[model samples]
Target: MSEKTGQCLCGAVKLTARNVPSTFNICYCDMCKRWAGGRFMGLHVAKDDLNVTGGDSVTEAVTSDWAKRAFCNTCGSSLWYEVTDGPYVGGRSICVGLLDDTSDLTLGTEYYTDRKTRAYDFPEGRKQLTEAEVLALFAPTDAEEGEPE
Candidate 1:
């Protein structure tokens, strides 16, 4: 893990992340594609590992019941996608394109593989997960419903 710094296009939103990972993931879910104007390349990091400046210029939109997406209000640059509920609450996925140095980063996973369009395709041989698989892995199970009476 290493420290990294980046900012939005207009420099209205700056961020410094510590203990950053060496790999990033891509999301091809419909919302991600629409929000990013394509696939969303993100680095999953704990909220505690990230620090943001120019927060006044950042705007967050609750896109779903469990997640919120943030962007630079001044420049409209996508900032980060954050989980707000369930097992992954407080987790943040920072936009990979915002990183100052990406030379050492590698593709970790491609999520929502089933939602990926044919218009674009990454190289083969990388790990991929469909929407169902992702939900199954991360979605919280009902405690009582799963337990035997």
Candidate 2:
């Protein structure tokens, strides 16, 4: 496994992934879109395989049912996608941009395709979905403002 490391734009926070990911996903989830202003690539990183070095300045945001968004407080650099749901099922969706080199690996999988806006078309040639599809798969536990759960 090749070593991968990255830091915020201001160098205030940094992280390292000890091993390369076997699965990569480009998510078009609404929350992701709101967070990144568009699609955010999520590389399935093993929880135990990730380590943060200069992490004191890294900020975390709890977004949903079992998800959290991490970023640099000073630079606002999107860091990693963390899901803390206990040992066996826990994982992190690391940002590919954080890697030292991403020229070798290919895009493995794309998710949250259903949440993409109708105006933007994806180029990955992967399966596509719409808002309804996303709601069907993973809907909010409680009723939304205009929608029923």
Model 2 residue 117 lDDT score: 69
Q: For residues 1-149, what per-residue lDDT tens digits would candidate 2 score against the true structure?
A: 56677666787877787777555678888888778657888777677888887677888999987789998888788887887565526678877776666776677877777776665675678788899998888865555645654
Q: List candidate 2 segments past 4 Å from native.
A: 86-88, 118-149
TM-score of 2: 0.71
**Model 1, span 1-149: residue lDDT tens:** 99999999999899999999999999999889888989999998899999999999999999998899999989899989999989988679999999899999999999999988877667689799999998889876677468654
Error of 2 at 133 (Å): 41
Residue pairs in clash, model 2: none
State residue 117's C-alpha deviation in candidate 2, in Å. 3.5
- What's model 1's TM-score? 0.80
